[model samples]
Target: MSNKQPESPDSAEIFERITYLSGKAQQMLLDFWTRQEAPAALTGDPFGMTSLWPAMTNAALSDPLRLAQMQFDYMQQAAGLWQGFLSGDVPEGAEGGAVRDKRFGSEAWASAPAFQFIKQAYLLTSRYIMESVGALEGLSPREQEKARFFTQQFVDALSPSNYALTNPDVLKATIDSGGENLLRGTEHLLDDLQRGRMKMTDESAFEVGVNVAATPGKVIFENRLFQLIQYAPATETAYEVPVLIFPPWINKFYILDLTPEKSFIRWCTQQGLTVYVVSWKNADETLADVELDHYVREGFLTAIDKAIENTAAPAVHVIGYCVAGTSLAAVLALMEERGDGAKVRSATFFTAQVDFEDAGDLKLFVEDSENASFYGELSEGRGYLDGRYMATTFNMLRANDLIWNYVVNNYLLGKDYFPFDLLFWNSDATNVPAKWHAAYLRDLYRDNLLAEPGGISIDGTAIDLSTVKTPTYIQAGKEDHIAPLRSVWKLTRHFAGPIRFTLAGSGHIAGVVNPPAVEKYQHWTLEGTLPETLAEFQDAATEHKGSWWPDWLNWITPLSGEQKPAPQPGEGKLDALEDAPGRYVKERIA
Candidate 1:
C-alpha cells in the first residue's frame, strides 16, 4: 500500500459506484452450530453465479458487436487515463466526472496519477458490466432481475474503497495509526464473530425503553404471539375511533418510535389519535407450530378487539406495515367473510404487498416452488426462522449502503461511528415461527396466491381481498426494494374500496416513518383515477413537499369520527400489564 495520504479535492465527487459486497462466507459457516437450538431458516444460496454466467455467455455469443464496442470504449477511457497520468495535466472531471462519488471521493483518487487511472478504469468496467447485463438477451424476467442484482453485488463488492491498497483513506489511516487501526479493526471483526452479529451502531449508546422506544405507554394485553401497548394520550381530546398499528414482525416496533423527534407513534398521539401498537413476541421452539391462521386469529383479531374494547368505540382504524400489512389484508378479508368487517372502520397499509407478481429481490429467496420443501427444511428443526438470516438478506438488497459502508468505515478505516437509532433498531432482530414463515413464503411469496380470490384460507375461511370493501389508504415508497412500488400498487386492483394511494420519497422505513416536522422526504399522490401502471401513477401523481404524514391525517381524520376526551392506557377491559416498549421487544437471539 502507498504511504501517501489522500489530498483534498475541490469538491468530493459522489460516484455512481456503490461500495459493498459478499457476506462473509466464513461467518455463515461458523454460526451453524453456535446458532443455538433455534430453527434452520433459509438464508440463501450464495447468489447463483449460474444465472449470471449464462447471461455473460449469451452476450458474448449473441452480440459480438456490443462486446467489441464495450471493450473499445473501455480501452479509449483507459488510454485517456494513461495519457493524463503521463502528462501530469489530468482533467479533474474527465468524461464529466463532476458527480460526487464517495467510493473515490478522496483527492488522492483524483490527483494521484496511479489512483486516477485505477478509478476511471474501474468506473468504465463497471459501466460496461452493467450495460451488458441490462442488454443481455434470452432470460426470463425473474432470471434477468437476478442476474442484474447479483452482478451489482459483485461489482459493488469490488469497489476500490474496500481495500487498503486501493482506498487512499484506508491506506492513510493504516499509516497514520502505525497499523493500529488494522489491529482495532481485527478486534472488532473478532468481537462480531463472537457475538454472531455485525455491530453497526454503538449498542451501549441507546437502550430500548430509556431512549429509543421511550414513548409513554403501557402493555395492556399479552398473548403467545404479541403484546398490545396503548400509548398515553398526547392530547386532551381524541378521535372516537382508536388507531391500532401492526408493525412488521420482521423487526421490532421501535422503528415507529425511534426518538421523541422521530417517533411516528408520538406524532400520532399529538394529533389527538389514540395509538395502540402490537409488539410481536420473538418466536422460539415453543411457538414453532404457529401458522398464518394462528397469527390472523390470535395476533391481528385480538389486537383489533383489544384496541376497540379499551376505547369502547364501535370500530378501530387499523394500520399495518410491511408483512404485517400483507397479513392484515387477509384478516380484513376474513372479517368481511365473517360479517365482522365493521370492526375495522378503515385500513392503512405501509409498503405492504398482497400480489407477489413482482415481489422484488426478496422473492429470490423462494424462487422455485419445486424447492418449496427446501424452505420447510430450513425451519424444520428449530420451528422458527432466525431474524439474523432475514436481516442479512435485507442488508444484501442494498449491500452498498447497509453492509459495505460499515465494512469500509469500521473494518477498513477503524472509525467509530455515532449512534444511529435506525441502525440500532435494524440490528435488533426477531425470530419468526417456522411454520408461519414457510406458509408465508409458499403462499404469498412463492405461489402469489394472496391476490387471488379464495387463494389463501385461514382456518377454513377464504380471504378474498375483493370482499374487503373497507376504505383504505396505501403508501408505497418509490425506492422500496423489499416491497417495490409496482407490487404495492397492484393492491389497487384487489381491494374493493376507495383507495387513496400515495407514493413516498424514500425507501420502506424512512418513507413511512417520515414525520411532518422534520420535512425530509417528499411524497406523491394522484387526485383522479388510479393508473394501471406505477409509471403512469408516478407521471400523473403530484409531488408534495416534506413528509406524507399530514396528507394521511387529512384523509383519515374525516373517517376517525368526532373528538372526545382522550382515554389513557388501559382505561377499559384490559389492565396495564407493564410499562410501554414491553419485554417482548427486549428479547434477543441467543
Candidate 2:
C-alpha cells in the first residue's frame, strides 16, 4: 500500500508445498510413516545416520528459508553436473553415451536446481568482488581488475580437497579437544563421497525409526502425567538390593536400555540387580510449574522412599547421568545431612559435576551478559526453555559436522535422505522449566554454590557434596565436553567415604556406553589408590586396552554381593513391591 512490492503469493505457496513434501519425505525415511531403513538403503551403513538425519531434515523441512536455501544449493550442484559433462569428465560420446548425452546435454540444464545454486554462489562472490574494488575506487583500473581476479582465485581455491590439507592441524585438534571424532567422522563421509567411493543419494529430510519398539509390560505406579512401566526380570529371580536409575529428562530412558546386546539396563538385570529407572515426564508449557525441587521431591526422593519402603533394605543405589547426575549428588548430600543415610547405600555418578570452577566452555553461556539476557527474556515468555532452541545450541557446538557438513551434502551433492537412530534421539528435545533452569545457571555456574558448603540452598537447606559419606564410584570421560573430567574428579575430594574414579576412552555418549568392543579404546590405570588430580591420575594410570565395561562389571560386582540366587518375588526385603523393575518404560511426554 505504501509503494512497497507486493508479497509473492506464489512464493508462499511454493514454500508451503516444500514444507509438506519435506515432512512427508522425512517421515518415510524415519519409518514414522512407513517401515524402511533409509540409511541402509542409501549409505549401506546401519549406523550412518546416528543423530544427524532428523536434525538436518527437520531444519530444512519446517523452515521456509532453510528449505529455500536447500533448493538454491541443489541448483548449484546441477551446474557442476553439467560442467562435468561439458568437460568430458562424464561420458556423453560413447556408444551408450547417447542416453546420457540426451539427459545431461539439454539446454534445460540451465534451469536445473543445481545450476541455480551455482548462479547464486557466483552472484554472492560478485557482490564481494564489487565491494572490495569499490573500497579501492581511487586505484588504477589495472589494480581494480587484479583485485577482482584475486577474489575469484580465492573462491576457486576453496575446494574440499585443498581445504582438507590446508587445515590439517586444526582438523586434528578436535581429536584432542573432545570434538575430534565428530569432525573427523564427517570428513571421512565427505571424503568417501568426493572420491566416488560412495554414490550420492537423494536426501530430502531426516529419517528415524524405532529399532526395538515393544509394549512396556504395564504401569504399576501411575501419576497424572507419568506411567511407570513394569519390567519382568530377564532371569529366574533378581537381587535383594534394589536400584533406581535416573536419566536426564531430555531423552528417553531407553537409551540406557537401547538394545539387548548394548543395553546397560539389560546387563544390570542379568547381574542380579533389581533395577527401576525414573523416566521423567517431559515438560511442556502447562508443566511449567514443575520446578527442579519438585523433581527432587515428588520425582526422585519419592521413588527412593518407595524403593526403601518396598524393599525394607537398609539402602539402595542411585545412578544418574549428566544433569540427572548433578541432581543425584544434591539429593545424596541433602539426605546425608538430615541423618537419612539409611536410604542410600552407595551412589554412582556418570560424568556428573558438583564443582563449577573447571566447568569448561559451557560456562560461557551463563557468563555472557548479552546471551543470558536474551535467554532470560525468552524464558519469561515461554515459562520454560524452548526445546528446539536448546537443541539448536547443542547442534551449534559441533557446527562443522552438524551444521556445515549437512550444508555441503544437501546443497552441494544434492544427496537423498537417510534414517538414523542417534540423530532421532538427538532431535527428540524436551523443554526445561524456566524457574529450575534460571536457578541452575545462577546457583551452579554463576555462584559455584553446589561445591561450597552453604552456597546453594533448597528451601533453606544447603547442598554440600562434602557432607555426603556414601561410598561412591564416579566415572568420567577423558574427552567429555559437557562435564569436564576434572570437575567430575573433584567429587572424590568432597566425599569422605571410599571412592573409585575411572576414566573412559571416548567422548560423552560413547564413553558412558563403552561396550568394550570399541576399536583400540583405553582407560586410565588403577594402582593402590585413585590419584588426587585428573592430570596426575591420567599420567600415572595405565591405559587399559579394551572397553571399560568389563572393568565396570568387576568393580561393581564386589560392591554387590556374590552371585547368590536372588529371592523369588515377595520373599526378600523387596517382598512388599509389586514387581521387579516396575513402571519405568520409555515414552515421549506429550
Instruction: TM-score for candidate 2, please give it.
Output: 0.62
Over the stretch 263-284, how does candidate 2's per-residue lDDT look in tens digits?
6776676666766666666665
Pick by lDDT: which candidate is best? 1
Candidate 2 stretches greater than 4 Å from native: 1-218, 222-230, 368-372, 517-520, 562-590
Candidate 2, residue 483: the lDDT equals: 83
Name the runs in model 1 displaced over 4 angstroms: 1-59, 62-69, 89-98, 369-380
lDDT of 1 by residue, 4-54 (tens): 988743222211111111123235446654765543433344345555586
State the C-alpha lDDT per candidate: 0.83, 0.57
For residue 141, give model 1's deviation from the true position in Å: 2.8
| Angstrom error at residue 380, model 2 | 6.2
